[model samples]
Each structure stands twice: as C-alpha cells, then as structure tokens.
Target chain A: MSTISLEQIQREMAAAVMTPLTPDDNMRKEAPDGRSMERVAASFIAPNSRLTSFERLEIYNRQYWYRVLGALAEDFPALRTVIGSRAFDAMSVGYLKAHPSRSFTLRNLGGQLASWLTTNQHFAARRADLAVDVARIEWAFVEAFDGAEHEPLTLEQIATLDGGSYLALQPHLQLVELTYPVDDLVLNLHKQEKRQATEAGVKHDEDDHAPAKLPPIRRKPTYLAAHRVDYSVYYLRLNRGEFHTLRAIRAGRPLGEAIEAGVTTARVPAARRPQLVRQWFTAWAELGWICAPDLDRLVRST
Target chain B: MKNQLNAMLLTAALSGLIGGTTVAHAATTSASKTTVKAAKAGLQYVNGDKPAKHSCKGKNDCKGQGGCKSSDNGCKAKNSCKGKGGCATDGSKMPKAV
Candidate 1:
C-alpha cells in the first residue's frame, strides 16, 4: 500500500488529540464542546483507555510538553524575568508554535530556542540581541550539565607536548561569547526572584509583590566558559586573555602558540608574559581543570 | 469457488495488515511507560490532591495542604465579586482589591 498522505495523517492526529478516553481502556473522542463522548469515541478514539491506552497517551502528551516547557523556563528564567509573566507565557506559546517538540526525549526541546528567539517575529520585537544572548547563556548552562566530561589539560601533559603538539579540549567544555552582559542579568534576576519569595514569606498573606527591576545594562561584550567539575556544573567568566588562550588551545594550537595568542591579546610586557602564563596554568590546575597528557595512549588508540 | 477463496484470502491479508489488536497493545505499552516516567518526575494529575475539609475562622487561618479545599484546591471565595479570588486572613481583603 502507498504511504498515508501527510494531510490525512494530520487530520487523524488531530482526531487522536481531541479524543478523550475513560479508565476502562477505551477511547472517547468527544469534543470538549458539549458533544457526546460516545459519538466522539466511535469516530476517532480507539478502544485503549481501559488497561492503559488513552491514559498513557494523554499522560505522555501532557507530561512531555510540561517537562520541556519547564526545562526551557528554568534555563531562560532571565528572559522570562525581563518580559514578565504575561509576555513570557505568550513568548512560550510562540516558541512552541515555531519549534514543536518532535524528539522522543523532552530534554532536547530548548536547543532551538536561542535561534528561535533571534529569528522569530514575535520575539524579535523585544531586545532581540540581549534576549538571544540570554538564551545562549541558558542553553550553554543546560548543555554544560548534560554533555559528556573530559579531563582538562594538565601541567605534565603540557610539558611533554612542548612546542609542536596541539591541544584538544574535552567534549564537555563549552565557550560562549555574548554581546550583552547576559550572565549578570540572569544572576541578578535569579537573586531578585529569591528575594521576592523571601519577602512574600515575611509580609504574610499579601500577594502583591511586583517583579524586580532590570539591572543597568552593560556595554561591553562578555566571555564565559562552562565546564563540569566533580559532577557539578560551574560557569566561570573569562577575561580576554583567558578566553583567547582557551580558544586557541581548543583549536588544537601548540601550548606556545596558545600562550602567544593570550599574550598578544592580553598585551602584557615581554618580561611578565612567562610569569602571567605560569599563573594562568597554575590556577587552572588548582581548579581541577587539567588532565595529564597521554601521548602514548593517543598513539596506540589511533 | 476459486474466486471466492481468493477474496477470502485478500480479506485475511488486509486484516493482518491493519493489525488492530497489536496496535492497541503497543499504544497501551507506550502510554504506561509515559505514566511511570511522569510519576517519577513528581508531576501529578489535576485530581491527584486529596480534598481537604477544614473551616477557617479568619481569612488566613488555614495554612498548608490540609486547609479548606477551594475549587482549585485552595481558598476560593463565593458571590462577593471576587470571581475566583481568595479572601485574606481578616476575611476583608481580596486578591485583586489589594
């Protein structure tokens, strides 16, 4: 038989959605608009609610979207804070409309939100750049938590690699460059939410807590790095020198070349460059950011 | 006779292709897994909460889950132009009036 037409499938899908089922493994495809559940069931809903069909299907639809939206909101709370509850709800509706959840797993839903915010007409009216930046930071935070881990480069590894060897970062490491001070905005908004919740407790029975005001905007672009350490995610704000060095290292540049990029961008004096580089490496080591070099293992594995 | 036999065979094939019984079974399995996962995630149904039966003296008398049950499972006022708003502890202030 030929594959079902897309239109027919969509109609059938809509019919499935509209149908409600009873507890006895039966389908009740009745419209909510005062229609008889029997007729609706006869037309669309399959006999499935009793043992588990309708109950399970309906539960999946409800919970899948709920979890995805919940995770999205958790990550992009700053965006929500900025727009307030009303607009944020509207924004979520628009976002879901543009990017419906198709994944079997709901954790993947917010991956497209940053791009959606940037390109979608509805979200475009707001501060698009800042909104996109916030979304990016949020996405980075989620990704950092979920992505696989790798041991960072260690001093011993650096010593063995010498001049010509290129360094590769772990898959779990993430670098985000944003035009706005997104991290600061999100942190401030989170703080405000906590404070409001605290104050609401203090005042007793008054539900009129206005949202906290937005912080003063910053002009400079921000650089951020997110990495998993000790099974917990930590985001560190990176300065120009550190960001450049890390980027170079990630690009598989030699240790000397990476430090050179850091030096040039950092504009440190010739005499102090070595000392500065040492300090940076030392800091990274102390933070559990580096893994020992394994050239022999790399050779044997390849 | 041969034509009738061919028609019966065709019907049997179509029934097998449709496979209503198996489709129903598979759907039930899928839905059950979803329910188990949702329960694990701590998302309960609208009707999941047990209705509390407590009469409060003042507006904010009852605090916590065991308080009087409202329509949405909290304090809901009636016939006072409140329109789904809760009365305060003093039974004077409304959510919107504040």
Candidate 2:
C-alpha cells in the first residue's frame, strides 16, 4: 500500500466534495483518471457500522451543495422568484459548477451571478433582462449589508467646502442605474416574503417558494441607491439627474464637475437646475451618503 | 487473495446500498420534500431572525403612484411621499415648467 501525504488527501477530499452528486455513484467520475470515484471515497472516508464509506462521503457532498444553494437563494430571493423554483435550482447548480465558492465566507458566493446570467440568457428566457436587474440589486443589498463603513460628512464640514475640494461617498454606498424598475420589484418581493414568514410563523425553506404574484414588468429607466444606515440596508430611489450626478461623484469627479454634469442632464430643465442641485445635496447629507474628503492628504499631494 | 475477495464483496454491497438510497433520496428531494433521515441530519440552514430593514418605509413607490411625478416644471421627485410631507428638502420642486 502506498502512503498518501496530507496534501494529497486534502486535494482528493476537495475534489470529491466539489464535484456534483450522482445517483448511482456517490461521486462524479471526473476525478483524476486513475482515481475512480469509489477509490477516492474509500481512501479518506471511514465507514461506521451502519453506513458504508461511499454513503458517508456522500453526506458531505450533498451538504456542501445544499449549503451553497441555500446561501444563494437567501441572497437573491427576487431572482429565485423571477425564474420559478425548478429552473432556479438547475441554474444555481450550473452557476456553482462554473463559479465555485473560492472565498472563505459564503457572502461572496453570488458575486459573479449577475454577469453569469447575462451570458446564459436561457436560464430566464424572455425574462433575462428582468433577472439580471434583480440579481444586480440583490447582490448590491448583500454587499451593502456587511460592506466597509465610513463616517458621513457633517453639515458643519459642508458649510466651508471649497470649489477645488472633492467629496467622497460612504464605502458601502452602491449606485445602480437599471433599465427596468427592478428596485421596486426587489423591495416588494422582500416585503412579501417577510409578510409570509410572519403570517406563517415559519420562514419559507423551499428555494422556489413563490412570492406574492407581481405585476408585469415594464421597461422603465430606474435609478437606485443601496446604502446602509444604522447597520440596516435600505434602497433609495433616484431620479435621472441624481443618479448621473452621484455616479460621476463616485467615479472620482470633483464636486463642481459632478454638479455641472448632473444639472446639464438633457432630461432636466435648464431653469430648475440650481434648486435641484441644492435639494440633492441637502437630501444626500441628511441620508449620510456623503463623506468628508481627506483634505490633509489632498493638500500634501498638491 | 482473501483480502482481495473481501474488498470485492464490500465494494459490491456498497454499490447496492448507495444505489437504493440515491433513488429514494432523489424521489423525495425532487418533490421538494425532505425525508425523515435528511431532517434528522439537519440539512438546511435557517437564516437569522433579523427582519428586513424598513428604513425606506414611505420612500419606496413600488405600488405605482408618487415616485417621480412630473410637475409643470419638470420631474418633481421625492424620497418618499410626494408634495411636502416628509424629508424637508423638496429638491424636485421647481418654480414652474419653462
């Protein structure tokens, strides 16, 4: 008998657990050519009196997939609702196969889901665009929930702002400009799910648990701000001008330049520009979305 | 030779056992039903009881009206509840449409 090193054992275990489950076989045959699924399972897993070695290993394999799938479903409830349960299950399995959880935390599991769904439109068929929008917003919510935090700019600080000064946004603040009004859809679905959970006194465990029936999706330009206030994530609706201005600011544009860009929006009337800009800053300040720029660092750089 | 024979017999028995269990598992799982064995194993992870945040309670206009209603001037948008209710700054309010 050949002695297997700890590294080899770990590698084999990972391969076995990562591979999708099979019906007749406990492991997929995609393991290294020489090591059959049975051989890999038997090598590391020890069977108890009641369970066989393969069955013991199978337990881990099934749990690994279920854990990941459950995390994804929790993250993207609206996405799951948009595409029915059976399709969601199949799509999630395929997505995990393509982009396995590389990070230690399950929080980053669906990081690549929105992009993945774009290329694989067959998953949602005609509703592909809607799915993409929901996925993006949901992922933003997840990111904002535990993303980095920063102190917001105080009104006193803003009172003495210079034109040359640049403003920064909170680290967790996310601005998403979407084609369909999916922000509303995501929020509605989230509320409905919560209501159902409350009324039933138990959370919906099934992935395909349909949310209350939603209205037909109509294509309308939507802007959304996903930000955390007091450790809770909330979605704020933005108008066309506000979205453009904030996006410019987030993209590192100076405050003056960002305001100029926002007010110059073709959709916004030229006459109402000044009042609109004032209102935007006031509301953003109240919401704690703006952060004071590091003036010391800026001066040193200059 | 005796050890090899024992290994072969064990392999055969394991294959039969796995096949039967797999079929049974598939039938129950596909129907979105968990079997007693699976339930006992505690396969599902329930999320914590933190309720969804309601920071944007009156803000969201998913029900249709009062989002970005266009006034005579242009788009008069409100963070929540249009026309001078909550949130002091009415940035969306313009003098009159030009």
Candidate 3:
C-alpha cells in the first residue's frame, strides 16, 4: 500500500477543488488528466453512507468557486453594474483563475482587475475603455478607504519654500486621468446599487431581474483625485495643469520645476496663473494633501 | 521672461497671500468646481461573507421564506435568518449557467 504524505494529499485535494466546474456547476466526472474523478476522490475523501466519494468532494469544489465569486462581486459592485452581472461573472472567473487568491485577505482580489480588463476588452461588452476606467476608480476607492494618513504642511512651512522645494501628497490620495467622466458615473452607480439593495433588501441574479441599464456616458477627458478626508473618501476634480503639476511633484520634482511643468500646459491665463496656483495650494493644505516630503532629499536638493 | 514670471508667481503665492477671499472666490469658478465632498455609500460585505441576499441561482437578492434550496422557482431556503452559516451552492457556477 502506498502511504501518501500530508502535503501530497493536500496538493491533490486542492487541485481537485480548484478545477473549473462543469456547465451545470458540478465537479467533472474526470480529471483534466483523464483520471476518473471517482478513483481520485476515493484516494482522499471517504464516501459517506448517502454520498459517494465523488459527490462528497463535489461539495468543496462548489463552495470554493461560490465563495470566491461572491466575494469578487462584493468588491466590484460598480464594475458588475457597468458590465451587467452576466458579463461580470465571466470576467471574475477568468481574472480569479489567472491570478488565484494569493493573499490571506480577499480585499486584494480585484487589485489586478483594471489591468486585466485592459487586455480582455471583450468582457466589457463593447464598453471596454469605460469598464477599465470604472474598474480603476472602484479599486482606487478601496485603497483610499484604507490607505495611510499623513499630516499636511502648514502655510508657514509652505512660505519657507522656494521653487526648488520638494513636496509630498498624502498616502491615501489617488490620481487618475480618464477619458470618461467616470467619477460621477461610479458614484451614481454606487447610489443606485444602495437603493436597489435597500428596496429588494436583496441583490438578485441578472436572470431574475432585467440587466442594469446605464445612462449614455459621453467621452470627456477628466482628471480626478480620490482622497480621504475625515475618514470619508471624496472625489476631487482637477484641471490639466493641476493634475500634471501634482504628478510632477509626486515624481520628486522640485517646486519650481513642478510649477513650471504645470504652468506651461496650464489653460489659465498668465495673469491668473499665480492666483490659481495659490488657490490650488490652499485647497491642498486644507485637504491635508501636501504632506512633508523626504526631509533628507529636500535638504539635499535645497 | 517665462522663468522670471514663474519665479515671481511662486514668490507672490508662497508669501502671506493665502486666506484671501479674492482667490477663494476664484476657486469657486464654474470651471473650478474643486470642492471636497464624500459619497455616502452604505454597501457592506466582507470578502467571503455571503451577502444576506445571495440566493441560490447566482442571484443574490433573497431566498424568501420556506423556498426550495436549488430550484429556479421562487423557493426560499429553510434558513433565511441564519447569517454567515455556511456556503450552500445550488449547483450553479459563475461565468456559466447555474
């Protein structure tokens, strides 16, 4: 009799559990390697009086996919709404299978969704770019909700800086340049989801209810920052100049250079530039965005 | 001239020119709708905690009272009030038919 090691047994069971279910959501009768599932199941799972070894193992297979799928649905509710539940399910399966859960927490599951959608556009049902943007904002929401917090620099600290000074943005702040005005769309979808979740007190399958219908979203180049304020996540809109300037500063550019980068492409007139930059800084300070940059680096650069 | 202009702008901004209503007023221009506002979203569910409404047929709406566990018709599960109890699938898979 061949004695199996505990590790070997776990490997076999795990492989069996993760195998894609049949169309009917049942465990396949045969393994992908053409081995009889009955024989394979008997090797590990003991048959109960009412259930065969295959049937017993099937329970686990079903539970694994169900829990993971439902978990993903919870995280990307907005994405699911954008590309109806039916397509969302398909995308979830493909994404999970490719990047199987490696982290102890499922919170990290949809981290790769936006990048995955960039290549797998068909999953969005013709709303490929919009789907990617929505996925980006949705994931940003997750990060901003729990990302780190840092104290912003005061006006005195701001006054001491020349154009060569370096600045840091808050850790929780996320910047996204989008081709669609998706910030509003995502917020609306989330509100609509809450309304439905409240009304039915349940989120039913796509078949039971009509597919989610969304308003026609026109393409508009929008720059947004998803940031945390008083523990609540807020979406702040930005102009082209502000976005690039912040981008430059975040990239470690000195204040002068960052402002120069911002000013050249700025749409605000020359006379308005100074006043506008001052206002942007005021908002940044009020919003606690301009945290202290690396002191050593700042000192060295200055 | 541009570099000099940028330096002057930086000097004027960094000086005690904040807290002025003139600029605060400018901040509210229609194009400058940059106010901070939070979205009051109440959707709640952990990763694996089956949503209370996750019914059997891949529809997570609800499993009303006294319904069948695996049937397509309006059959509710025996345990409607039981929360986070266990994963009970009705033989339906994702990205595919239930």
Error of 1 at A186 (Å): 1.6
* lDDT-superior candidate, 1 or 3: 3
Classified by CAPRI criteria, candidate 1 counts as: incorrect
> Which candidate do you rate higher for TM-score, 1 or 3?
3
**TM-scores for the candidates:** 0.55, 0.68, 0.73
Docking class of 3: incorrect
Chain B TM-score for candidate 3: 0.18
Q: How well is each residue in A190-274 modelled by candidate 2, as lDDT tens digits?
A: 7766667679985545534433356887999888888765444667778887788788777767766676666567376544555
Give candidate 2 regions above 4 Å deviation: A23-26, A29-35, A155-160, A203-213, A293-302, B1-98
Model 3 spans > 4 angstroms off? A4-10, A30-43, A155-160, A206-211, A294-302, B12-98
RMSD per model, one decimal: 23.5, 28.0, 10.2
The most accurate candidate by TM-score is: 3
Enumerate the candidates' DockQ scores in order: 0.01, 0.01, 0.09
Off by over 4 Å in 1: A1-44, A47-64, A102-104, A121-124, A153-156, A195-212, A291-302, B1-98
**Sort by TM-score, best first: what order?**
3, 2, 1
Q: What are the fnat scores of the candidates, in the order listed? A: 0.00, 0.00, 0.11
TM-score of chain A of each: 0.68, 0.86, 0.86
Fnat score for model 1: 0.00
